[model samples]
Structure formats: C-alpha cells, structure tokens
Target: MNLLHSALRLASAESPPPNLNGVVSTPDGIVLLGLRGKPLPAAFDMTQDGDWILPSSATTAPTARNSYPAVASIGRLEDGSTVFTDLEADSVLHLVGNRYRAAELLRNIALELGTSVWAEDLELIVVGLDPDLTPLGHHKVETFDDLRPALQRFTDGLDLSVSELDTGQDGAPARRAAGDPSDALVVTVLVVHGVDLYDERLLKDVCERLLARGRTSAVVLTSSTATSLPGPRLSVDEDGILADVEWAGGHVRAEQMPQDLAVSLLDVLATAQAPDEPVPPAAEEHPWAQQMTIDGAWDPELDEPEPAAEPLPSPARTTEQERRLVRVENDDPDLDDDLAEWGDTETPARPLIAVLGEPQVRAPGGPPPIRAAWQIEVVVYLAFHERGVSREKLTTDLWPDNKATSASNVRRTVAELRPWIGKHPTRPDIEFIPSLSTSGDGRYRITGHLLDWELFRRLRKRAQARAAAGHIADARADYLNALRLVRGPILSPLRNRGYAWLNNPDQHHDTLIPGFVIDTAHELVDLSLAEDDIEKARWAAEVGRLVDPDSTHDSPFLDLMRISHAEGDTGAMRQYAELLLAERDFEVGEDLPPESFEVFNRLFPNGLGRAVDDR
Candidate 1:
C-alpha cells in the first residue's frame, strides 16, 4: 500500500484529480500516472477505493520535496482473493483498477488471434514520477535509461524484426513502424508519480514511442475537469469520472470509464478471438470477421483476387505455392542461413499421414479423408513409408489373441483399403498409398506415405539437437512446428472414441504417445525458459496438461512455480503449492517433493504469510 499511498499523496499535493491517475504535461513538467484505490475528491464517487497519482513541478533534485510514509496491511475478501497493504498496495490497486482491465483485454486478444499474448505479446512501459514508485516492481520501465534496453531485451532472440529506431531521441516512435511488428504485441503503459518530479523529457518520449506504432490503443485515466493535454474530454456524471483521450492530429475523444466500460472493452476482445474453424459466410458481414482470416483482413486494393483451388501436386512436380505452404514455419533467419550451406534444399516430397491423433491420410494441401481401422493400423506399421511389416508380424501386432483368423482379416482389410488409395477418380495414375508389396518372405510394405507423428518426432529431435548446439532461434521454430502437429492425443476418436469395440481397445494409449508428449512438452518448456520466453513456457505447460491431466510428474508444478515467481503473484504461488501437494500425494503417495517445499518456504517461511490466515 505504500507505493499506492505515495502516488496518492503526490497526486493530492498537485491538484489531485477526482479519481486516480492521468497524463499531465506542463511547460516545465510532463508526467503520466495510472493510480488506483479510492477517489481523491469527495465530489467524486467514494465507493471506488483505487490508487491515485499527482503531478509536480519539474526539477532535477536528488531528494523528494515531500515523501509519504509506508503503510502496512494485508488480508483477503470472501472470494479468496488476497488484500494487500504496505508496499504491496500497488498490487491491490492494479488488481482492482483499469490496469487489470487492460491485462484482461490483452488475454482476450490472444484468444482471438489463436495465439498467446500473455508475456509473449506485450511490451510494458511504466514512467513513474518517483523511481521508488514502481508499480509492483515486476518489470519497471526506467524512463529513457530503460526504454531501449527493455524493448531490446523483450524482442531479442525473438522472430520479431524490430526497426532501428533511436529510442533516446525525443520523438523517435515514427521510425519503429519500418520493421515487422507482427512478431509480438507491443503495449507500453507510462505511470508517473512522485512529489518532486525531475526529467520530464522521458515522459513525453514514452508517449511518442507508443504513437510511432501503427497499431496501438491509447486511453488516458484522469479525474481532472480540465486536462492539460488537449484531447477528447469525457463527462463522467456524479457516479462516473473523466477519461480524456488525446491522440495525434488533434484527434481526441472522452468517455465514461466506469465498471460499465469494462464490459464494453471485453466485447472488443471477445470479438477478436471468436472461434471460427473456417469463418462462416454470414460472419463476413461483421466488421471483426476479417480478423479471422489467415492473412488478416483482405485488401481489395492491394491483395490479389481470390484464386480458384488448384489440384494437389504430384510427387514429380512441385508448384511454388505448394512448396511454400508445405514447408514448416521456420521463423529463424539464422536457421535459414545455416541451411543455405546445404544448397537450395526444397521441401521433401511426402504424403501427409496423420497417426499422432486420429488416423487419417491426406495429400499435401488436400483434405483428410475418413480412414478405416485396419487401413490406419497398416499405415502405422509403415510409419515412415520406407519401412515394411511382415504379414505374420502385422497379424500378431494387429490381433495377437485372434492369431488363427488374423491373416484372413488382414487380407480383407487391405483389399478394401486399396480402392481408396491406389485409384483416385480424379487422378487414376496417382497412388496416394501405393499397392502393398509382398517380399520374398511374404512381408507386406505400404510405400509413398509419410506419417505426421514421424515428422513431429523428427522435428522435435532436430530442435533438441539445435538447442544443444546453442541455435536457440532455430530450435524454437522446430519446437513450434512439432507442437502444431499435436491436435490431440495420438490416434484419437478411434483409440479414444471411434472404434473402442474393436479387438484392440482404445483408452489404453500406446506407451509411446503419452511418453512422447510429456517429454516433448518438457523439452519445449525448458528451451522456452532458456530463451526467457515465459509465455511459450506457459503454453508448453498447457500442452502437457492436455496430455497428462493428472500431472504424473513435477513439471507442471515447477512451471507454475516459475510463472508465479516471475509475476510476483503470491496467490498463484499458494495455488501452485496446494496443487503440488495434491499431485505428489496422488503420484508418489507422500508429502510434496523437496523442490515444492523449497518454493513454499521462499514464498511463506513464516507460515504462509497473511495469505494462509485468510483461508
């Protein structure tokens, strides 16, 4: 509460606003503060206890002209959310204020994008009047000194191609648009607080930095009836407050930012992340529907006309478009350079065989056809296409208990499967899955098909090797590709739902599927952490949860611990500890592991702090 109180004191000292937080720019000083807690003015609503910030005269003094004492407090509400006091007041303010609303908005954006924006997409910037008034101290943006380094650190080693902008310059944001901004979402929030403010230049620089971006949403939180910066002025009635927003080109609009505002903001994010497998025809009428497209909204002026579908390419010929789509999304420039040494390598020609999830076969750039049980089983045996299975081995593996009648069943299944693969009505000569070959020993082999699981395995292996060699960017791309192939557990529907009545029952997964998924997830998380990618690490843990919902191991616990530590979220820490206790008891039939205890001890060596008492 100390930081929040300090900010409030500063705000009150400098003609405090009706509510908390605002952007102030004077001839001698410019400060941006987003405060929370309660309304500062009695005329304003008293029900909202949010943080506050103040504006002060510009000066380069070492000590503050006025300083507030620290406030100590802690507790929780009925809903189990913790209440904070002392320096922890900033947390309470943010959790209850518009800052929390902004975070929720970002999450909703991620959901809409079919990608994560957690820590992955955001770039935060906080401009405080007093250096000590850092919000949560999670990752503070230290004015001019911090902007470049912070932005560099966040974007570094990422696929994002940031433009070379002179961030130290007063108004350098315009240059940032030259680089590709799609790699990550950059959101900079400037919070200025303190009585004796100095170096007002950085405050202006931060606003410009955000303005330079082609895509950005800016909102000004203020309780002032008269805003210093010229912009749109909102009229918050007795129960409301002013939110004056001023953008470039004198474009300004103001509005009421009360609890109702949150609902409106949420609608924007929800619309962006609408679940559309393939956007419906009617959806096109909606303004946000264009966002669902792969390349975003279609541009009638710049974009080419919609092209008719071309027939799938044969093994002998490759179209340029087909080649591009067939190749995995490798984001690393360095990896491309490394691969260049091997000459002009093209996407290897291979038919798409999906075995990791439901067993289905589809040609490159073609739709997946429904496959029979035996057809899928045969394809699984010839996973790499180059491999072959002996007729006896196939029977034993397919139906060991029914060995007496296995051969006839296999023969019947193969005969039925041939027409679907060997002779397509459109291309009579093209063999999606070539006729099975009988070796001298009567072993059967299916040629010209590639299994998706095998490809996923190869990609994971390559990523592992690249990571070992310290080619992190290359490794990340490979890991992403590998993970993308995992739609569900290996051989789903058939193994999990479709044909459980078959001789080979499902639910009992192949030992390989679960083990492979868990291992790959761990590797992905580890690699992501090494690259300082908390969001990717978080996503990896989610993938692990999908595969091993019971969390048979400690990876999920460790992941939660790491996430909580990075965010300085004590509640998350408590949740992680409780989960670990339950998980460990179930898995090992013992108390939580030493690692879990170590984290718990660090978070609450003094009996779980006030958080435990609330429970």
Candidate 2:
C-alpha cells in the first residue's frame, strides 16, 4: 500500500478506548499507559513480556482533602518556594489547576525512566494522547513506598528479557559478566496523544531531563504554542496537514511529515520483528500483566504519610532499689518500713553472703555460728574463686555414688540451705538462695557469703603483680597474707566427706578438690620458693601433690626437689624425686621423668651417676 493509503487506513482505525490513554513505541520496545481495571486491546502487541502499566487511580469519585498529615502531601523544592503534590487518585485538571509541582516530579520520573530503559538501540518515544494528561496521570507516586515496588517490577522485566537473550533461560544471569554497563541498555517510550494534555511545568521538566542526557526528542504540538524542549518538532495545522515548525531554541531538524505518522510508527515498532517469515505466537496470558491490578487502598481525604514521633524521655535513675536491697541485706533497723512499698508479688531482697573464712557473717553480731553440714559442703563446692561451679560438680560432690538421686538430692539440699541461711540474723529478711535460675547447664551458686578463696586469689594475683613490679617486700607481705588465708584444703572440714560422688576412677581420688584450689596450692609453692623458705615451699608442694595426685595441675613440685638438694638433704631430695617419678608414671603409665633421676644424681654425686656413666 502507498503512504497515503496507509496513513488513511491508520487514521480510520483510531478510536477512543476508555482508560487507554495511548501507545508508546520505541525502535525495539512498546509500553501501554492507561487507568486501572481496563482490559488491553487484543490486536495491540500485548506481549506482557516487556510491558509495564502504572495504575493511576480507581474509577471512583474524588474525596475531601485532609489537614496536614504525618506524611507530606506536598514537598518543597531546594528554593523552598515550589510545592509538589501527589497525582495518584487525583484528577489532572485538579492538579494542574493548583499548579502541580510537575518539575520535581518530572525530574524523578526522568531518572527512573532512564534506569528502566535498559536496551542499547531503542529510540526514546513519547506520545501524548490526551491534551491535558499530567505526569502522574490518575495515579500517585510521592515517596519511596510508591515508587520502589513499581520501578522494581519494570527493572525485573528488563532483567528477564536480557537474561533470555544472553542465556535462553528465564532468570539466569547474563553470560557477559564483565560486559560494559552501557551494553545492557534501558529503552523507555513515553506515549500520549497530545502535548497540551500535560502540565506545562511537567513538559519543561521532562524536556530538560531528556536534554541533559544528550537525547534530542521529537514533539507533536500545535503550530502556535512554543515548547522549550530543544529537539526535532512536528507541527500539525488546523487542517491536519503536517508542517516543520521552527523555534529559536530548536537544535535538531524535523522533516515535514504526515499527521498519520504515529499510527505508522506504532504498526512498525509494536509488532514482533522476526528474521524468518513467521514467529511463534505469544501465550495469551502472562504473569507480568496478570498481576497488574490497581492496589486500591487510596483514602483520598487523608494527607501524605509523616514520620513517627519520638518516644518520651525515660524517668531519672534512682538508688531506692539499691538502698532497699542493701538495708534488707544488712539486717537494718528500718527493714520493714523500707520494704513496705514492695508488694507481695515483688521479689524479696537477696542476702549479702560472705565466704572468705568458714562462710561466716560479716555484719557484727548479726548471725551466730554456722554449724557444719551438707550446706557448708554446697557452699565450698559452689564457690570456685571467681568462676561458677558446674551443676555436675554439685550433684557429684553431694551424692557421689548415687547418679539417679543426685538431681533430686541437689534440689533438696539447696531448698534446705536457702531457709537455713535466711534464718541467720545477719540476713534474716533476705532470701539467701534467691532463685534456682542457674546457667544453661544447671550450675548453682552460694549467694550469701563473700568466699575466702576469692580473697585469697585476689591477694595472690596482687602479690604476683607486685613481684613483677619489683616490689619484693610488698609481694612477700601479700604472699604471706594469701597463704595465711588458705587455713586448710579448699572446703576445710567438709573436704574429707560428702564428695563420694567424685567417683571418677580414671582420675586420682585427690581430684575431688576443685582445680582452682589445686592451682592456688601451686601458686603458694612458687611464692614460698621465691621467698627462699624451704619449710613453707615443702608444705605448699605437699598440699598441691596431695590435692592433685594426677599432677595435671602442674604444680611446682620439681622446685621442692631442687630446694631439697640445695639444702643438702639427700633423704628429702630422694623423697621428692620418688614423688615426681610416681606422678609421671601415673600420667603416662611409664617410667619416671629423667629430671627425677637428675635430682637423685645431684644428691648422690658418685652413687647413681657413676653407675649410669659406666653403662
């Protein structure tokens, strides 16, 4: 068919479709713009594969505008003079009548549109169908919530198309991992029937964004009104004859073309272009378009979304709770009055317990003597210097051979101990064992007393620090003080009994003593040796060896042997060597360490040493 016939046929085919604004066709892609809930034309390229529809509004009557809300309905520009409002669910005439903030909106649209069009070779096409169509049409996109989801959908379609072209898979990554960013292009076509249908500010803003991107656009406007957008221009006279209208600001040339050019452009660009004579027919339904229903939750009267208010300031801190707890713990004179505000449901104050020596009462004349019982055993076992004792330790230490009864027995023992300690005058008002909330592993602790072992450890650590600082006198004083506090093995009176549950034949019987105590014994031995007190060193080493038969504690027992040799006590040296030998044999099930023999050789120069040399 000739150009005239083709033009006449295209013009005759044009008809007004409700909610269907117009078609936007680039060199390679097409987009359909319209109102929500309208069926698309079957004859048009409804591939849905590359189509994106932005729903303007529901076909409902306009509602009243609400007062200024949390979310700003209108945002000001950098100059603070211009205010932009949402176009979604609002009429173009209404928005234009109020001089809509089209420039700011258009700037955002341009940026988004540029990002959305990701194909390298398609020409940018903008068609104006209605002479008064605004940038938002009937839909609104003001904040991130409104724009991001729709923009993502459009980009997702582009990504899918690029993936299919590169790898023939729906969502597979593009094969060109290192491809230039420009190679993966985005081509967007804005379609409207008439330029006059859009707000003038919006038109100017759209033109500016396009020009900034170095794109020269073509506009179809009446011969009279001049557009600032510098590009190729097509003027249609009242008679519908196409004329090349020149503006002073125009840079790109436009040839005088027929008024039916858009129809021909649509027919050419919207249809599938297959290299072969025929292409396979597209599926009737696609997920992309099927999911494009208008999300109709627009309460027209409401204002734009605002930020949530900050929370009220918290009340000032008070020491009343601490004071109450302290008073209850100290058995104070005003305990009842101080605790009056605390209701029955409120937690009772916990006792301030001490365990530095026999777990006695630190408060003067508060509590009388604490009798020796399983409660004392529980305290010693629970108090591991700074570390918490394990539940297994409590169960085993309390009920050695009876595995089944251990858990229940431990519970009973703790229950009895709680009341017993609470009855003490020092902490009569406080619950000694506050709660059964132990660690994840069911470990327990004594809450009432300050443990002596903890004080001993702190003193020993301080002594070591002093020695390292060259304060020998201070260190010696601290060491003496720490050793004086030992009194006896960690638990003292209870150490001999109540640990039948420590029935580990694999470890020596002496392993019943906590490892921390054994370590403390080793520290004492070292301090004694450093002080050059042979008697004290011997005592400390013996205690360490007795408590740690496995020698796993790695005490300084060898130092004791060396000290014996230095003192010329052959018998004592031999005894220490024998002990060392026995320890090594226990550990490795082998002969004594060579260092033990060295001790013997040193003690008996010409005796065992000569015999070994002869061999």
lDDT of 2 by residue, 1-615 (tens): 010110100111111112222222221111223212234423332222322222212112211211101001122122211111212111010111111122222232222232222112222232323112223212311122232343344344344444444543311111221222332332323322223424344455444433343211111111214344443333333332223321122221111223254334334333422234421221112211111111111111222224226421222312433222222223223323322322222423433333322333222223324544555555545543123455576565566655536466667666766654463345455444444563333446555344344334444544544454455676666555655554443333334555453354522223333454555555656666667777876766665555443465434455566567656665665565556555554311012233443434444332211211221
Work out the TM-score per prediction. 0.37, 0.31
* Count: clashes, candidate 1: 22
Candidate 1 residue-wise lDDT at 395:
66
- List, residue by residue over 1-615, the lDDT tens digit for candidate 1: 132232222221122221112122111121222224322432222223343323332222112111111121122123222221222112111111243233332222222212211122232333322222122223322333443343344334121322432222321112222222432223333222220113223233433433344223221111222223322222322322112211111221111223354455446445644554641121222222221221121222222235437743333325543332222222122333332321223432334566566666643323324555655555555553244556676666655556448566777766655554454345666554444442444556655554555445556645654565456887788787777667765565564333332334322444346556666777888888777787987888777666564467666666766666665676786677567766654311112444554544444433232222221
Worst lDDT window (10 residues) for model 1? 64-73
Residue 414 accuracy (lDDT) in model 2: 67
- Candidate 1, residue 288: how far the Cα is off, in Å: 44
Off by over 4 Å in 1: 1-350, 363-374, 384-387, 400-408, 423-440, 495-509, 586-615
The deviation in Å at residue 567 for candidate 1 is 2.0
List RMSD in Å for every model shown.
24.4, 35.1
